[model samples]
Target: KADAKARSSIMLKAEAVSRYPSPAAPLAYGTAGFRARAELLEGVFYRMGMLAALRSRALGGLAVGLMVTASHNPERDNGVKLIDTDGGMLAVSWEKHASELANAPVEQLNQVIASIVVAEKCDAASVGTVLLGRDTRPHSEKLSAIALEGVGALGAAGRDLGLLSTPQLHHLVRMTNGEKGAGPYVGDTAAWNSEQGYYTMLADAFSALLSSGGDRASCSPLWADAAHGVGAPKLEALLSKTPQLQVAVANTVGTGPLNDGCGAEHVQKARLPPRGYEAPLAGRDRAASLDGDADRIVYHYWTKDGSWRLLDGDKICALFVGFIAEQLDALALEPPISLAAVQTAYANGASGRFVKSLGVPVAMAKTGVKYLHHVALENELSVYFEANGHGTVLFSDRATSALLAAKAEAEGASDEARALAAGRLLLVRQLVNQAIGDALSDLLLVEAILALRGWGAAEWDGLYEDLPSRQSKLPVKDRTAITTTPTEERLTSPLALQSALDSLMAECPHGRCFVRPSGTEDVVRVYAEAATQADADALALRTAQATWELAGGVGEKPTGAAA
Candidate 1:
């Protein structure tokens, strides 16, 4: 703890010195930042210090910090991002400067930094402070040293809160920056943020559902794979509410995260139960894995005999949409509150139809949460989901007002009337719960719905789930060279993109196909939702092949970045 404090002090001092240095260029922010290629750690850090200094000045001399080093990304991939005063991502527009800083040449970068100092009326030698934090990856420590050097060179204080989870760093950043009170505390759990109001909302809704359904017997257990990121610490706060809810957590300890062996990206293999073919358990044990950031989930459930049945992101969305719709019907609610499920082009066709069948509206958006967040915010959507397991629901003031007004109409209503009204509201709450897109949250939702309907896991998702859907990541060498440069220019031209989409349309019922360059990796992901597993696989592979062919081996080049 003392060592940590000392490092923090050093970083603080370093930050103050670097205030006057010009930033490299503007940093672009996507849902996450355009991840810094792994080999570019030095470049990212130098740029991060500049960006942090700029933000500090922007916020009226508040000390800002940089979380440099990609959490859970590959060894060759690194990221530099800032946690806001409230511990959430900064506004998208703010990242624009960071992107600029990243793209600027060294000479111009120094000038830009100098200019920022002039603009802020601060001496080039006396900028504000910056804090530095890193995780457990082997590269992380070395990266920290280099970043600290940069920060120190700029006369900014660089603190090393060595070996903390990403979220813990987030919390510390908030508190140290005056967003929260000083803890003066150290150790694993002390630094965890208590502002997990979002997760709490989901739990409260789930608890209400279980209570209403007469399934208040006992809270459910949570078996989670945190993927050794920030998830475990944040989830700990959530589990605190329902003490009866047992938690069997794995992969909770580690420095490096987000590898192939852990998280939602890892496929769970089916296990055969003991006692040969006549074993009481016929299928394999099932589990869910969360990615490094803990925002994504991929589910694995067991069959009657114990065989494993994997549930992807789209299926998870479908189950919630369908369940919520029926619950509303039971309460005699009409039009079902105009619920909207926002999906990406990659979502499975059956899942899309299933959501629509539940009497809810659907909107399709470009890949990634940036666009989805905008659409949800603008449209006042009741819910939004992504097939990649990244989603959030909008509890818009308008929607809440509508719900409250409806409740007022139910005042003095009989027990039956109250139940009906409650059911309708519960349906909306369920939509929010599922829309969190966190796997454990999804599991809780599924279990609650099952209890209400008296259905088992298999029966809960409704009719046979249509057909086989398959997704695979195909390498596109030098995908960047084929598209654009300086990172931001990589966007595919509309004409080219539309042409590809048109060709993919031919694979229908065979499944919908789309090409997505990974936000954090080099490979492009191809997804297909078909009427048959074979068809889905073939179509997805073919489309992927076609996309690469069109790119003329652009994606096949060695970008040397980590996923």
Candidate 2:
């Protein structure tokens, strides 16, 4: 009876919304989910809701999450990424199903859903739930409504978390699913499921970390660029609770164009502070930029010589690895805890060598957060980051248990050893977001580390110098022809392409080059690094031209920077 009712409701809702014309171009579920012009995402959003309902039903009603965001993209663009019960990206296997459902013609929509139902063996009678959240994008509200309508049609329950960061939504999904059937604290589950809980948890953790460390007053105030996105107000709320650290926020106007010449992407690409980001911060004061969705962060600061220095993902990983390794060494447990940092080919060679110099192992994974996250899981303590600033720290169960045990044992030790062990362990678990890369969480972690080490951005930047590098995108008739090795450090297709690149690289000091298809865009990304900026740029252009010639490029040969 329940199954029949759900089917009826679903059909009615689908029938009403299904009348909207399908897009001329089929939607492909990319690494970032269905992202495009906001005007074209209504159908995709509706179908994603249905898929989320099915996913919830498949998991026996554990809450799934739907985040409406385009991350670093401009405000005109919008996207949706499904969150699994574990608060991670949707399983790789289901991406195909999502693509099929999203692009299915209206006439065949029901057939597509039926196919998925038969294949996954989802019980229609089972209850389904979806937790929905959106960034501050203008189109988010209408798109969210369309999603909710789809959920209703499926007869699934949903809670609209009015406005939230991507990480906040992930945190809620994990807390909701993890806390199920487990008795809750603070009156009920609602307390933990709200944004209040999210802010409180991070605030409390930050407070604990600050209290456990040396004088916090000596820390310099940070200049933060919120990219005029949702993170600004949320960050303000967060800082209110933990007042030890002061931050001056920029580009926080809600009505402003998101990621418009600002945000992590801008900071990283331009290697400078965002436009309109003057905060009177200079000398020792640090600065950071959060993407439109606040899932990634990149740090920079003005030096005494008046040059802006960037501390990218690679540097962040080094700092984290060094700190964690020091803590573990102090603990000196019987069963050793292995610490490793994960990076992509985009990582600067200097960063890799720096991490190795600290006696920490480094692993290279293909581009994308899911791939990095998976490889990070192999180590007891994994710190993964992309050069573009998307990443997080993961602590295995063994590492968490060992840390707790060490902290307990330290309670009876000398004051110096006890403070080192307990404080470091607690701070590690509290400072890093295990679920995903969170700009706010990472920002706090960076601040805490700077304060503890008594080092300014200059000192940290002095750890290593990034080799001159250039990245260019070449449009090809078929980007799929450009296949790569597992680590994306070498090209496996376009026979002899790697050889040509190697020859060019051999001519330049410290030169390296690689080509891979962009997962999120329709271009072949060519990366080259060398001893000098001019060589790097020239090598990148040559490599891109070679790839274009080999991979069926669409137009005339690319030249100069466009190459």
Candidate 3:
């Protein structure tokens, strides 16, 4: 009888599915997932809803996630991405299957879904759940509603978690599917699985970690720019959970569209403060920006010399990995757990060198959190951060076991130092959202680390000098024409373009440059770094010029003083 209900559900959904027609152009799941103008995404969302439910059924009724957000994209745009049972982005191998399902013709949709079920060995008749969350976009609510219908079509439950950040949804998915933590951050704990529980967990972890590190009183006030999206409300709710951090949030609401002139991408790429931050940040006045869905973050402030400075993912990783390594060294456990740092090709040359100096191996991956997270998981404990501020620390079962055992022995021997060291790492794991990179969670983390070190924003920047670097997007007739090697640090196709780009990069002292298609948008991204700002800008411009001329660029050439 249950199987009959499930079979009929798919047929019932076919009628509703016909309402949303696929766009004239096909959609491909990119580094994140399927994204496009809001008008073109309804069909994708409904299909993803079914896919999410099927994924859950395949994994034995474990809940999956569907987040209706376009991280860092403009309000005119929206997106939907599936979260796997592990709370990470949908598995890479299955991305192609999702693409196939999304692009299937409406008439043949059920057949395609059946094909995926058979290939993936999914029990389509099994009941499952999909947790749905949406951003602040006007269309997000309606899109999520359509997705819910698709979930019902599969005879699966859809728990709608309205208006949540990207990472929040990922957290709930992992927790609902039974991810466990050592102490209070438990998956089976029903409270920790709710949106409010999310805030409470982050707040409690921050409070404990800060109090443990001594003098939380001296902590400096930090303000987070909310990017006029769901992060503002989430940050406010976080404040309700704990009052320890002397911080304030701004850009809580905006009359204009979301991320119009604010966000981590704007701050890091455009080199300007987000809107509503008219007052210049100086001295120890630390500030951070969150993208649309609040997954990425970048810290910034104005230097005394009136120069603006930004601390991005590379800096975040350098600070975090160095601190974690120091804690491990202090513990001096006989079964010392291994740790490393993983970065994409976009990381600064100096940042990698600094992490290597701290005695942690730095591994390179392609430009995506999924790639970096998989590579970092190889070690017992690994830190992965993209240059754009999308990252988090991953703790494997091996690391957790070692730390717990070491702490037990230390306690037995009354070794206060080792016990505290081991405890600190555990507390950190509790504080961070291990599911994915979270801007809100990361804000608490950086602040707590600074308090422990007695270091201010300027002092953190003083740890390493960034070689001047520039990142820009060159418009092209077809971004797909460009391809790269595995690392994405070097281009492989268009031999003529690659030849010209290499020559241009070699001309600058300490120059490094790469060009590749942006997985999220319709442009070719170019990056260059050099010993000085001028050289970096010039090299970037030259390489973009090579791509423009060789790879069929659009519009007028990118004119700049460097050019």
Number of the top-ranking candidate, with TM-score as the measure: 3
Candidate 3 Cα errors over 4 Å, as ranges: 1-16, 179-188, 281-284, 561-563
Candidate 3 lDDT tens digits, 1-563: 54444445555554436887666688889677888899998888888998998888777778889999887888988899999887888888889888987888898887877666666666656687899999999999999999998888778899998989999998888777764322233434576878888888888878887777775435787878888888888888887877777667777656557887888988888878888664665333778899889999999887767677899999999989988999899898776889999998899999999999999999999998888988887888999999889988888887887888889989999998888888889878877888899998988888888888888889999879999998888889888888899889877888899889789877899899989998877899889899999999998888888888999989888776233
Error of 3 at 187 (Å): 5.0
TM-score for each predicted model, relative to the true structure: 0.70, 0.94, 0.94
Measured by TM-score, how close is model 2 to the native structure? 0.94
lDDT of 2 by residue, 131-177 (tens): 99999998999999888877776778988988899999988887787
lDDT of each: 0.54, 0.82, 0.84
Clashes of each: 61, 0, 0
Question: Total backbone clashes of model 3?
Answer: 0
How well does model 1 score by local distance difference test? 0.54
C-alpha lDDT (0 to 100) for residue 379 of candidate 1:
57
